[model samples]
Target chain A: MIARRIIVLLLLLGALAEAWPAAQTLVLVVRRDSPVTDLDSVTVRKLFLGVPVLINGTPLRPIRNRSEPHLDEIFLQQIVAMSQPSYDRQILNGVNRQGWLAPSEAASVTRVAAELNANPNAVSFMWERDVAHNPNLRVLRVLWSD
Target chain B: MVRLTHSLWVRMMSVVLIILAALAPLLYLGVSRIVEDGYQERFINSVRAYSRLVADQLEALDAAEFERRAGAVLDGVVLSGQVVFAQIVDGERKIHSSITPALGAASPREDYTFGQSPDQVYYISHQVRRPDHAVVLRLGFDEIPTSERIRATQRHVLLAIGGFVAVSIGLALWLSAVIARPMVLLQESAKRVASGDVHVQLQSHSSIREVAELNLHLERMRQELVGTNEQLTREIAEREASEHKRLTLERRLLHRERIVALGTLAGGVAHEINNIITPILLYAQMALDELPASSDLRADLQRVVESAHRARNLVWRILTFSRQSDTQAPSTVFALRAPVEDALALLRAIVPTNIEVVFRCEAEGVQLTGDPNFVQQVVFNLCTNAHQAMRRDGGRITVTLAAEEDPGEPQLRPGRYGVLEVSDTGEGIDPAALPHIFEPFFTTREVGEGTGLGLSVVHGIVESMGGLITVRSASKLGTTFRVYLPVAVALSNAAGAA
Candidate 1:
């Protein structure tokens, strides 16, 4: 009986982890000094899925952030509109079919912010709060909400 | 059970089998552990090294194109056939190969060593660093083949142990036969020796030191036994020859003794008959003298006188059979000491060196009215019997002659006599046998030792000479025979005493 309670408690914790991201929103982020601004959800998704995108004829670099537990899943659901497996399949399919290089990845919000500052057209997903106090970073668009 | 215990082959084989039974299983277990351990160690080392090589390759990959070729790299890992599962994980993202890990087998758990998981998979992980992030590469190597190898090696070990046991038992059998063969041969030889074949040498060949030494001792014993048996056989043969001679002599002496006894009995009857005849003859003659010169009564008295005279002649003839005339020589007045000395001289020459003769003649002037041979014969018989009595231990034979007076016994009158006493410090006669000693054919000596007639003849001679003989003996002490004879000088005294 104790084991069943433990398992149910773990299931409830997992549900809360998935449900807690709903109050937060993920925005496409870049360096404040870069020319990138106001990118649409289509351009954002294309940039994260290993498709090369251009703004003012400048090549864009997409950075994947893994700072939060369900942040990537929220981003892939709202903007990319795909499950985790399907999104991974689509990105690997582009690398195999079109011979495109995979996008760069970062594990922490600080490393994501650092990559955007270093690259003039680098793009990434982060919580609104991460760029809220950073003067060097800016949000091009809302990547996801809930 | 008896047969099995007695058999050498069974005994040796059982010992070998027991040793093997104890050792073989231990040998199998130890060897199997070593073999399985060898396969397991090699399996774990190689799998871990292979997984490390894969992670290193990923670290060197082109980071800009890693995601596009990551699936191909992981697919290549699965194609190696040892990796039943392959995946690259970076935080919440996991990129896997096309292979579905064991095709619905039980889920693979991370295994730290060989045989840790029931899924027959060895799980290992290596971290590959990319320019942007690090991915952890994990691989599950198939464990079934290594397990199969271990099992096969263990089977081989078991078979080898079995073979060793069999070879050991075979060697024991051969060795036991080598030892038992010679012993069995020796047993047969011993049986032959027991059955009186002393000539059968105790021989058995063996290389074993103790057994060879035993054979040597047995052969020596057999040789000694043979020599002893031959010596015993020779002694028995010599004894048999002496015995044959003794029995023949005994038979002859027995016949002679019977005749002597018959003569002595007849002589006693004749003496009584002669006394009656003499009275009849004298009365008949006196009656004739008182009758008339021509009377008819004189003829009848003449016939009685003639018949009495015939009867007297017959008595004299019967007296001759009493062994006194066996000498067949006429009697003469001879110095009895001379012949007595001569017989003693002869006895001294013939007797063995063991006996000593001591002679003393006190009656020097005494004369005996008989053939000198009678005195010689009597002395020879007495001395010979004394010599035989002392033959084994070699004692003294004493013979003495003296003028003595006869004791007033029933058979002996009080008179002067020449007494010859023969005594010996030898094996004495039994007191029970003394009364019968003077009877003919009665003897205490063994067969062929004497005719048993010596004392009987001596008795007859002394009686005829107006003397008597007597014997006194004690068991193991000594024996004495005193013969009293009336000499010429004692004739008047003997006649008056009678």
Candidate 2:
């Protein structure tokens, strides 16, 4: 009876966790003059992680969402295939080396995407629908699938 | 014996009261300003903290919750009779809630855009931030009652000032009286002293040291003044007595000199009278014994009577000189040369054969106003002295008659005076003997040869008639004697008073 009660408690905990709202990815967005067309998963990862962030022989940067920490976690896990433990270690190492960037909110990320699409040397990210009106930034599909 | 009050004390007290009254308002203002400054410091600190606490709570809650919480917080704050109002606003100046009952449910957001009221009102606004929105929390307090309280404070201040002024005035009045009382006494004492009461003095032991010292000094002055007054009185009495003694001595000396002169005159007159009487008696007996039975023996008897009458006239002249007994009224005017002529006639026989006499008289020229006897005496004495001086040398005498005008060095002014000068060319008086000639008993001749009262008697007669006599002589030059007699005042007023 105790085992049954433990199983039921675990089930209830999972159900409560699943009941939480899902957080969306924080995409990298840029202007149409951006040189990126076929990007590698590592390069996209490097850009989001603020490493080797040059695009089309010019420097680019990433934008982020500040809605929830879970959103950042989910984007790093699903898109960058980073586990929680490894991500914390990477963040700690980057902080120790003084090489980290803070995340931005959803409205700011879209604003960055619009500003970046008009410039050849800029890079930022947003949801796909958010960049639909901007003709400068082409979708740079990575070879890896989640 | 009088009681007195001092005036300085009253004056000093009044000065002190006036000084205190003048300073009252300034002192009150200074003290009240300090108290209000302290209150303002404490109030500012409490308001700052209160604004911060409310701002934090407002930022943490939603709009509805903020209104409820702010209302409750304002209700919870307890003020000690002071009014307070509180409100909350967003950064856009939108009012969320207000604790002021007078403001009602109205939103005065635009009114508070500048945050502070312009009517010298005191309010505190603190900004608070949340994840979603920023808000402003505000608190205010009314200053009308504070101003009224400040005004109310004046009542106490006025009471304090009044108390100080009253006390100061009272003290001043008391002090002035204390000082002025003795001074008033001193003034009265001074007045008494001026009126010749030197014995008055001020009492001692005044409230002020200076006043006490002054009183002591005044007492000393009084003692000194009394002593001085006594000394002056004694000196004045002694002086008056001494003056009286001197006057008596002068009178006695004058009387003895007159008696001696009278004795000399009496002997001369008695000898002449005896000689004249003897002759008269001898002539009368002869006429009676040798009368022709029917002859005119009447003529012989008449001659004897005439000789007797001449002797009596001479006796009268001597008596007049000796006694100065004539008291008849003075003549209005007479010729200056008449008395000299009469004196020359009296001495005609005594004048030597070699001496020639001359007389000059005008009808009314040299006029004088004096007893004829006194004038004659003055002339006779001088003529006799001149005749005796000339008899020794058989010299010539000149008698001049003129109105004296600029008579000599010490001249009398031009006026009517009869001047008779009997000048002798022989035996002029020495310079040394001239001054003493007018002094009684002073003579150049041997004591038996002359009676020295002649010039002195001349001086007396001339002075009694309000005239002056002067003599100038030298060893070889005959002496000149000028006599000055004043003209009468020449008005009827003088005769009226006389």
Candidate 3:
């Protein structure tokens, strides 16, 4: 009975590990009414990295989490194809060239979702699991696969 | 009482102190004012920059994010212990602050304002605009630090002013010494000069030109005084030597005058005595011829012999009067009338017949303490001068003798005097020559006609017998010589009886 119970516990632990999201999996989202339904990898990278992007004659505004290490790593590695420091440098360079703020930063996922709901041209990144509860937001692009 | 205000040092120091006293407060106020202005400008600018920075940060944030990070933002902006307080206020009366909530409850209504509390804290409030609220950033600065800075600057200014005043006083004292030293030395030298130190020499090496010139003038005056003193000494010595020589010459001249008087009297006496002696000898021979060798008529002839002897005795007395004695004879009480009569008798023999010789003895029995020969000689000399003076024009010669009591004569003391006055109505002595008439060899007569010793010898004889002789003469007027002899009081009664 002990041997059978140990085998069952190992199977349950493997299933729970399989259900969690990968460390680099981040989903780009926008308001449900936004004209930008989907974006190419280059367009998504340019929009989030402080470069101006337009879809269907409407400009896109970028949003970010203020202090989420996992999302920042995923976005820098999968979309920008640069290290975190290099990606930050690219964002600062784009801000200097464009003569505007790079992006609006939110303190948490709820704040990021609310920012996106309020602005139809706004864009942000979050965990795939958290996007299910935000009904006013839509997934624009997936940054990395599990 | 001497006043301190009159002192040069006091006056100089007072002026310096008054100027310094007025300047010190002004210097402190000026320095403090400049420092306060500088500190106030810097504080206002710093406060303005801090307020603008906070307003820009707030404008960029949403209401929810701003609410979440407002405390952290104020904490980041407000330096510990430097910014005394800081605050932010929302429209619904929700206030956030680094300080206590009660302290930051009211936002300043104005756009910008400054306030200071009694506790020496300074507050600068700035209004900021926001999307959902109005924010106020009230920053407090403790005034103690700024005040301390201003006070430090004032202290430095006071120290600088104090040093300047001290230096000015030292310079004034040095200048006063430089000026007063030479003046004090000059005053001392002048005092010595006033005290008759004519040999004082002043140094002419003063740095000031006027002082040096004054010293030069003082030295010149000293030299003049020395020269004048030396000249006066030389003149006094020369005058004394000249006076001694004059007195010696006067004594020698007096001796020569005596010899001249004796010589002049000897010739006249010899002629008169010879005339008397010839008659006596003739009478003796005549008597001898008229008498027999041994007759009774010889007794009558004896009377002629006695008369001849009396005539010879008179001749011997006339010869004795002409001689000068080496030693002074002792005085005796003698009747002044006798001397006057004897002098007249001698004068009658030689005086010309045209010149009347009158003798009046009004002093009846007045006696004098003097040599009889000297008295007679005085009368004879005066009569001889009178006779010679009148012989040319044949005028009258009057000899009068009188007794005087307390005669107020300038040359004679107040006493009873036997006064003998001889007057001649002849050519008078010149007014210019009157003062020297009694001097030996001082004569107005021709060389052979008269010897100058006549009046001088008369003056000498009268003075030696304790008498005074005075003469009064004028040009073309008659001359009178008056002799005053002191009366002999002891012999006056005896002589009066005789």
Q: Cα lDDT of model 2 overall?
A: 0.59
For this target, which candidate reaches the highest TM-score against the unseen true structure?
1
Better of 1 and 3 by TM-score: 1
| Candidate 3 global lDDT | 0.70
Worst ten-residue run, lDDT, model 2 chain B?
Answer: B106-115
Off by over 4 Å in 2: A1-146, B1-22, B56-68, B78-83, B91-99, B102-121, B241-498
Q: Could you give the CAPRI-style class of model 1? A: incorrect
The order of the candidates by TM-score, greatest first, is 1, 3, 2
Q: What lDDT score goes with residue B47 in model 2? A: 45
> What fraction of the reference interface contacts is present in each model, in order?
0.00, 0.00, 0.00
DockQ, ranked from best to worst: 1, 3, 2
Clash pairs, model 3 backbone: none
**Compared with the true structure, what per-residue lDDT tens digits does model 3 show for residues B360-423?**
8786878888688778878888888888887878989899989887776655677678899999
Structural RMSD, model 2: 26.3
Instruction: Give the alpha carbon lDDT tens digit for every residue of A10-97 in model 2.
Output: 9999999999755332345455555665444345556555564655466665555433454454354333434444545555666568
Error of 1 at B339 (Å): 34
Q: Write down the lDDT of every candidate, Cα atoms only.
A: 0.76, 0.59, 0.70
Candidate 1 backbone collisions, by pair: none
